[model samples]
Target: MKAELEQLKIEAFQLLNRAQDSSAVDALEIDLLGRRGKLSTLLARIPELPVEERSGIGTLASSIRKELQDAIVAKRGQFSAPTSQSLDFDPTWPGHSPSIGHLHPVTAFLERSADFFASLGYTIADGPEVETATNNFDRLNIPANHPARDLWDTYYLNPARAGLLLRTHTSPVQVRYMDSHKPPVYIISPGRVYRHEATDASHDTNFTQLEGLAIDRDLHLTDLLGTLEAFLKHTFGKVKVQVRPSFFPFVEPGVELHMSCLLCGGKGCSACKQTGWLEMLGAGMVHPTVLKNMHVDPAKFSGFAFGIGVERMTMLLHGIPDVRLLLSGDQRFLEQFHY
Candidate 1:
């Protein structure tokens, strides 16, 4: 019986060493130490043996059971240890490419355009999207019954409020800035503007506009023209600019600034409507009415103001066929600008 017990100890040790994983080790433990297992059976049969022999065999069995339990625990530790590295993720394996994002084309253009102005000592100014008719139109010399007001085609928030309307342009920012700051003010107001216009290939109900105002002593139209020409060159990179007679109620003499078709290099093209020029922005000296409304003496301080459509600028720069694409939020259209 003693020899059999010794052999069982050797067999248990061999089986424990052969267990490939924790599950196999658990199975072996149940086979050797469970209620119907050899160690349990031996412990149960002890009462039938002589007292002296029973004590010796029971002690040996208890020691062997303890040894087997320790071995199983140690083997489980070994099994678990290797799993972390065994199911090893190859360090060199290609990982999933993370989705990257970028600024919208309009936004990129806005930043670049803003930086260009900033470099020339122009600071940024902003105003509310919801504005009073007085600021949006009246102060700019568009009277209540003036036909020029029709050109804006405004979106009024409350007709009863009479003058409260969504701003049609960022020119209101110019008025607001001048109202707060004295002359020698150079500012570019870049923001979203709302209109009630029907959407088309060239128009959008919601768009962005950048309005620039420079007020100081002795500023003239030539200064305006030269500044605009430098800005256009910086923006479009070596392009011809043309200023034609135009009128806006806010200015005594306003002009439409145009840049040569960048796509066709000034040659006629569909993009330029075969004219070889694209109307870029509008500029004029600050109207007396506008200056008077802001309490700035128009005679003492002459200044120029210009408004440029950011969407149009972005569209021309990126060769986008439709202006609507700027606000479409379509991934396919936008992904092309990803850095």
Candidate 2:
């Protein structure tokens, strides 16, 4: 019955659009919204609906009916006699443009990055956001007592059973991928990650991360640096990249990848903390333990892996001041990116 109602609504709108005169619109209004109309017939069946679905179906039916009525009114008004010849305005006219739909900023950014990697023969990998402690931590060379765990405090959906929790990074996808695949692998894992942390303009409890992995014979730190540089240049268009020594359990000789500040043109600003470079990617050669955990012999296969905040890159690319705005459902904020 709900599906029938939805179909009826669509039919009503189609007929309404074909309405060429006030009389035609008036006929449609009565046929679709009158006491004996199609919508009225559906509403009459509300009591016949199942107990749990009654309220929801009725509400949806009501909303559809209301929209149909409004559309009818607006349609009829278009054919009605113009009250005045001055043409200054008409109170009943709808001046607002219909909303256009497009991809969310974060989704757009992820797709853009994925395309870049895909062009280079890297397959996209995926994993569940809810991950096991072993896959999320131990597989990445991070253990229960590892200090790095503190940096990514996360929510556990079921603390008492299996230590299941929301993954704090997309890197877990790499672990899952390696477990099932062998050497000569190239993939990018882009997905939402949860963190039990404070929300700010720059940070959120949940955000997107892009994990990059390339495991081919004779791959080196230079290969990782070059790939990152190309990605940064392709994404930001000629931006400078900096690599500094860093630490991540999953990677040996871990390094942080930084790009010149877009906000200040690398001159330095509060966004860059007076530093010309803003840290973008945490990357290095994959550690041997991580390979062993996934049943891949490190001696046989070596790879470089990196993770970067997708939303952070979106913010930088578009000069968006707040990370929250990327996910916020504000039409005004979103429509600005129609480009």
TM-scores, each model vs. reference: 0.73, 0.71
Worst 10 residues of 2 by lDDT: 81-90
**lDDT (Cα atoms) of all candidates against the true structure:** 0.86, 0.86
Q: How far is 141's C-alpha from truth in model 2 (Å)?
A: 1.0
**Model 1, span 1-339: residue lDDT tens:** 667788889999999898988899989988999889887876787788888898789788878889989998888888775566655777788998999789988889899999999999999998999999889988888989999888899688867888799999999998888777999999999999998888876688989999999989999999899888888888888767788989998876899998877667778765567787888899999888788887889779888899998887787887776788878889999999964
Please list the residue runs of candidate 2 whose C-alpha ends up more than 4 Å from where it truly belongs after superposition.
1-98
- Model 2 per-residue lDDT at 121: 90
Candidate 1 minimal-lDDT segment of 10 residues:
81-90
Question: Runs in model 1 with CA error above 4 Å?
Answer: 1-92, 263-275
TM-score of 2: 0.71
User: Cα-based RMSD of the predictions, in order?
Assistant: 6.4, 17.4
Which residue pairs overlap in candidate 2's backbone?
none
Candidate 2 per-residue lDDT over residues 35-76, each given as its tens digit: 998888878888887899988897898799789878887887
